[model samples]
Target: MDLGLRDATVVVAGGGRGMGLAAARCFADEGARIAVFARTRTDLDKAVDDLHGRGSPDAVGIVVDVRDATQVERAFAELADRWGGLNVLVNAVGPDVRGTVESLTDDQWRTAFDDGVLGIVHTVRSALPLLRRADWARIVNFSASSTQRQTVSLAAYTAAKAAVTSISKNLSLQLAPDEILVNVVSPGSVASDSLLAWARSVGVDSEDPYALMAAITEHFGHPAHLPRVGLPEEVGPVVAFLGSRRNSYMTGANVNVDGGTDFT
Candidate 1:
């Protein structure tokens, strides 16, 4: 279970909080050197501190919006200068807009695409060169289970993530010669700050976020097999595994970490 990640250079997008932070911590625990990217300086700093405190060989936070290609490129360059080369790139950044096609505005659609799809495109493009230089590389994208089982109000989000899955599959073929594995991890119902805030925004009572989430999940999220919601930590280890040298043959695969929530 070594994962062979010790001292590896890892870049985690949207690593400031939630599942991204969880993934960063998991990598750090395995002795990886981490460079976390997010837009907020405060959150980025705190995440880096937390990672270092958790036993990362080295940890740095770069403030960069993944939606901005220039910023992403520069951040990757900085990471390369600091860590020498990249071995893992986790696309944990995502947009939060949710609604059906009729309820969503054009701007919302564009924003969703920008945050979910284009953000991955920009980050992968920026990091491809460094990844190519590495003896082994992995790209783990955070897609969603909703892409497999369509949600009623998550039209735009699902569409965007579906695009991410498609892109990862295509890139897997292109990066095969380089031995760079590209794959998607579709998580369901992870209790993150973002998900809690989103629940509150959608009229869930702040005092009982879990109650609200449980009610919703019981009705919509537990159709597959496991009758429960997943946790950030539960999803993080899988991502770390996918990014590790241990994962030699798996690529272009959409692995569901959804507590069996999509089996309907």
Candidate 2:
């Protein structure tokens, strides 16, 4: 599947590492021009080099914190100067705060919304003009499956992702006339670095994907029918397809990549 992504310009927020980096690699494999933005310069530089090795014609990494609208605007301005237009925007950024409603502080709640929801707003708004300049445009925003399944410990995180899903749906409708497609991807447990660290912090002490999933299920109670956590590579294809010209008619949909969740 070519996905018609060659020469397409893509921007992946939080693409310095983890699932965002995985998705950027997918685009790079398709020979896309890629720009990845994140807070860490070191991670961004490494990601850029990896993308080039993966076959991206051009890969640049920007250091920007999505929670800050001013920084996001400046970064997008730089993108416009480099590419002049954008074909796809993959928002894989989110706040890592976790806690129950009662346990979470007011600052934590604000941080969650600011980084998760408002961050999406900042990126989408800044990218819209550039996306409109392209012949085909798509937005793929990451959500969480726990938003649907309802995890007590992930209340703040899930709530923030639910807002992301809502924003994507509304953007799909609002951007239809512009021929820009917007969609949401809700993922379950994936054995990414942050997740592995969390697992180890809780005494899971395993790097194996299945072991991590088992521990995750026992701790978080969000087990899937497949009985294992997914890998970052497993998610890249779905995001690539969604953000590619191959996805012509799908928009305003929340596609679950949750290893066969019970709710779906």
Candidate 3:
């Protein structure tokens, strides 16, 4: 299907790795101008090269932490100055905080909000002007199904994602008049290096990421309808479609890309 994404300028915040990079790859394959943002210079550079290889000749990567408003602004400004405007902003930036309610400290909660909630706010705030420059604009924020599911040991992470969902809903209302669409995509257990690391951090031990995810989800009582955990490539195309012109008239909605695991 033609997504109408050719030449559309897009920013995948935290696109250096995992689903972010996967989403960027999908966009690049659709012939979009891709700009990825993340803190690690090495991952960002490598991702840019991979995108270029995937047919986005103009793909570039920026090193910026979304929690830093100044860095976020500078990154978007640079993209606008170079690309002449922006079309879509995929907020693939996320935070992974693993702790039970009683075990999680105040500082961990603060970090969760800072990285998950404020991260989205900061990038959106900085990219608004550039997005406005386009005739049509869309914003896709990454959220987790953990927020909608009944789970234990991931309270802090889910709390932060809940805020992201709420913020995107409210922001959509304000941006609608301008014809700017804002939506959130919530994913369940997806296989990626980040997911593996997160699982390990929370005390799930496995050499294989997918195995770890299965164990975690089974223990939490939310399992994918599909046989196994998902892949970044699986989630990427859905995001590309939503961010594309093909997805008009859908705003303020939270779309689940989680293998039928979540009702929300």
Q: TM-score, each model?
A: 0.93, 0.98, 0.93
In candidate 3, stretches whose alpha carbon ends up further than 4 angstroms from where it belongs are 198-214, 262-264
Find the number of clashing residue pairs for candidate 1.
1
Better of 1 and 2 by TM-score: 2
Best by TM-score: 2
Model 1 deviation from the true structure expressed as Cα RMSD, one decimal place: 2.1
Estimate the lDDT of model 1. Answer: 0.87
Instruction: Summarize candidate 3's per-residue lDDT along 61-151 as a digit string, tens digits.
Output: 8899999999998888888789878899999887777888999999999998999999999999988998898978899999888888856
Clashes in model 1: which pairs? 224-263
| Candidate 2 residue lDDT tens string, 33-102 | 9999999999999999999898794799999999899999999999999989999999999878888999
Can you write out model 1's per-residue Cα lDDT over 171-207, one digit (the tens) per residue?
9999998889999999876667766776677777544
- Between prediction 1 and prediction 2, which has the larger lDDT? 2
Q: Would you list the rank order by lDDT, best first?
A: 2, 3, 1
Clashes of each: 1, 0, 0
Range of the 10 consecutive residues with the lowest summed lDDT in candidate 3: 205-214
Which ranges in model 1 have alpha carbons more than 4 Å from their true place? Answer: 201-213, 218-224, 262-264
RMSD of each: 2.1, 1.0, 2.1
- After the best TM-score superposition of candidate 3, give how far the Cα of residue 164 lies from its true spot, in angstroms: 0.6
